[model samples]
Target: MTLAHEMAFASPQITAYAVEATEYPDLARRYRVTGVPKTVVNEHIEILGGLPEDAFIEQALG
Candidate 1:
C-alpha cells in the first residue's frame, strides 16, 4: 500500500486506491479479493499479493 501511494505521488498518470475488504464486501466480491494487499490496475491487471516495487511497476506499466 505504501508503494502504491508512493507511485501515485511520483506519477500523475498513476492512481492508487486502498480498500478494506471487510468494509466494502461488494467491491471485494467484484474483484474476487481473497487476501489482503490485492492490487487491481485499470480493472484488468490483478496482483494478488505483495510485490517488490520494481516488479510491481513493471507489471502495472509494462
Candidate 2:
C-alpha cells in the first residue's frame, strides 16, 4: 500500500484502491487475481504481479 501511497503523492491524478484481504477473495476469484500486489487499471488492464515504480507507471499509463 505504501507504493500506492507514494504514487498518489507523486501524481495527484493517480487513483488507488485498498482492497482488504477478506474482500480480496471474492475479487480474486472473480477477476482471477492470483497474486499479491496485483494492480488493475480501469478494470481492463490487470497487471499480475508487483513492479517497480517506473515500470508500473508505464504499464498503467502507456
Candidate 3:
C-alpha cells in the first residue's frame, strides 16, 4: 500500500488504517463500507474497486 510507504515510521506524514469490514461492523457502517478493497484517503478521497499501481499511487497521494 502506497499509504504505508507515505506514512512509514521512518518519515511519517500521514496515518493509514486497514479495517476488516466484517470484523468491525461499526467502522464499516461509519464509513459506509459495503465492499472489500475500499480505499479511503484522508477520510475524504475514496477509490472503489481496483486500479493500476501508478493510478493507485496517484489517487492515494491526491
Clashes of each: 0, 0, 0
**Candidate 1 segments exceeding 4 Å error:** none
| Candidate 3, residue 17: how far the Cα is off, in Å | 1.8
TM accuracy, model 2 = 0.71
Query: Against the correct fold, how does model 1 do in TM-score?
Result: 0.93
Q: Which 10 successive residues of model 1 have the least lDDT summed?
A: 53-62
Candidate 3 ranges beyond 4 A from true positions: 1-11
Alpha-carbon lDDT, every model: 0.89, 0.75, 0.74
Index of the highest-lDDT prediction: 1
Q: Give lDDT tens digits, candidate 3, residues 1-62.
A: 55454545535676667676899898788878887788888788888887876787678789
lDDT string, candidate 1, 1-62, tens digits: 99988999999998888888999999999999988889999998888789888999898775
Best by TM-score: 1
Worst 10 residues of 2 by lDDT: 17-26
lDDT of 2 by residue, 17-58 (tens): 877745768887776676777777788887767788788778
What are the RMSD figures for all models against the true structure?
Answer: 0.8, 1.9, 2.6
Q: What's the TM-score of each model vs. the native?
A: 0.93, 0.71, 0.73
